[model samples]
Target: MRETGLLSLEAKKRHARTKIHGYYEGAFKFTRPVRLDDDCLSVYLIHVGGGYVDGDTYGSTITLGEGAELAVTSQASTKVYKTPSKPVEQHTKIHLGADSVLEYFLDPLILYEGARFIQNTTIEMEPDAVFFYSDIITPGWSKDGVNFRYDWVRNKLKVYQNGKLVLFDHLLLEPDDELEGVLQLEGHTHVGSFVLFHPEASREFAEWLYENVFESFPDVRLGISDMEGGGIVIRILGDRTQTIERILSHIHTFARRELLDKGEISWRKY
Candidate 1:
């Protein structure tokens, strides 16, 4: 069976405030949006499955109308079990209108032994819109007690601004082919990535990360660079999930202040 979710949001500029004008929810649901200053809204994504299984296919699309501001997060980590017949697939597309903003921070993703997974993401936004997105990938326990037990996982991302392709990133990990080489995971088990796109993204932001955020996490390996069109890409590798999570969390907090001129986002789970 195929599981799909659709979310469409529009902003209404009436009554001297910006709020959710209209929205539609499909298979995937969301908790009530927590309001914030300056027309910001935060919500948690909800799914009704224990985890993804073999031959499972899931797709979702999120659209933000002009001037809308929204933040989305997953309540819990995602788990992908063994996929013997067909690999589990996930696809997401996001659209941001002019002067809009979206912050999407999904919890860690776990892939068990013998699991096969594939993911594709596409983001289209206007020149003035901003997006802060991040994700972490972790290895699940295996009966053989061998690291890198999962079969394979491939992740691909494409970002477009003003209807023009600017960035394309692809990551393919094959453990059986010896991933400890220089260009591969390099003896790391957990991997995470943070992407920030804004018109003001520059080399200075990358320098700030090196001096402020990256130095705090001495154990994790990180790389930050500026995108061609205008944005930043950060890749992190660590042994523990918490270590990577902490590094990304710090970046998110600092970036929000500098990039969006907003305070910390309240992410209370309870």
Candidate 2:
């Protein structure tokens, strides 16, 4: 059976406080918006089955009104169970109004042996809006203790601002007979990426992030580059999931404090 989920969010300012309005969800569930601060709203996405199965399909849409601030995340890692016949699919779309802020950060995706999964995410924002997004992929345990057991994984991400395409990222990994010679994983079991798009983004921010990472995490390999529309693009590869997760958390925390001038966000689920 195919399962579908939908969500929408809007924010309005009332008496000097940002209040969330026009919120909706179906199939996929979320807890009531937790006010991290007077300006920030946090919501966590929940999966009904606890994991994705064969023939499962899910979609979510989010919109932020002008000057609204919202962050969307998942309660736990997305688990992709074995699916020998069919692949599970997920799609997400997000829209941001002028001066709005959005942060879409989620836990890693764990793929079991013989699992197949596809995901697509698109974001459209006004020229002055601020956005941050990230995700990770890690190989799950297998009985044979062999690496790269997943059949295939594909992910695509696109971002647009002021009706102009600003960034496009695509990733595909399929282990087969020639997997040994390929550099897909580069002898690593986990891979991750993060992106930040805002008017304040500059080369100095990217440089600072790149330099700071080397001092703390020497084992993880990281690459940082500038996006077309004044933001930072980061690619990370590591052997341990915890190492990558920690690195991402550090970056996200820094961005929130420096860019938004907000304090650390605490989630009860974690």
Candidate 3:
């Protein structure tokens, strides 16, 4: 079955809150907005079925009105179970108004053996809006105890500002034949990525991220670069999931405090 969800938030001066005006569908449910001391709304996306199954399709759309601030995260990592017949697919779309802020720092996606999945995310924002996004991919538990056993996995991310495309990132991993090849995992089992698109993301910030954040983690192979439209992109490869998660979390926390002027607020799902 196909499951769909939609959410729209607008800033209301009457109560100084970003209220959710539109919501639809099930399985892809969201909790009530939690007001943070930083005046930003935090919403958690919950998968009612717990994980993805064969032939399952899910879609979600989120929009932020002008001057609105919102932080979105998932209740837990997206688990992709074994699918023999068909692959599960998920699509997400985001829109940001002028001067709005959006933080989408979600958990990783774990793929079990025989699991096949595809994910596509598109973002359109105004010139002055701020956007932060991060994602990770890790191998799930297998009976054979071998890593990178998944059949196929694909992820695509596209970003646009003021109707001009600025970033397009794509990744495809099929570890059936050559798992240790240089073009594949390159002997790494886990991969993670982080992106920040804001007006203040200068080359200096990129250098600072490489020196301060990436340098702190000596085990992981990290790469940092500047995007076309004043954005920062980071890629990481590691053997342990916890190590990669910690590095990305630190970057997110630092960005929140420096760019959004907000203290780190933990999202407790358990």
Q: Which number leads on lDDT?
A: 3
**The best candidate in terms of TM-score:** 3
Question: Number of clashing residue pairs in every model?
Answer: 0, 0, 0
After superposition, the stretches of candidate 2 with alpha carbons farther than 4 Å from their true spots are 1-3, 21-26, 177-183
The local distance difference test score of model 3 is 0.83
Task: Give the whole-model CA lDDT for all candidates, comma-separated.
Answer: 0.81, 0.81, 0.83
How well does each candidate superpose onto the true structure, as a TM-score?
0.91, 0.92, 0.93
**How much is 69 displaced in model 2, in angstroms?**
0.4
Which 10-residue span in candidate 1 carries the lowest summed lDDT? 5-14
True lDDT of residue 11, candidate 3 = 38
* Candidate 2 per-residue C-alpha lDDT over 1-270 given as tens digits, one digit per residue, 9 for 90 to 100: 445555565665556556665544445777778876666778888876668877678877788878877888888889998887789889888888988888888889999988899999998999888998889998899998988888889999888888888888888878766644446666677888989988878898888878778778876678888976667889898878888878988888888887888877666675
RMSD of 2: 2.1
* CA error at residue 181 for candidate 2, angstroms: 5.9
Model 1, range 182-231, lDDT digits (tens) per residue? Answer: 87888888899999998888888778876787478765688888976568
lDDT of 3 at 114: 88
Tens-digit lDDT track of model 3 for 1-270: 545434343433225667665565756777787866557678888888768888888888888888778888988899999889989989898999988888898889999988999999999999889999999999999888999778989999999998888988998988865776686778888899999998888898788777778567766688888976778889898888888988988888888787777777677666
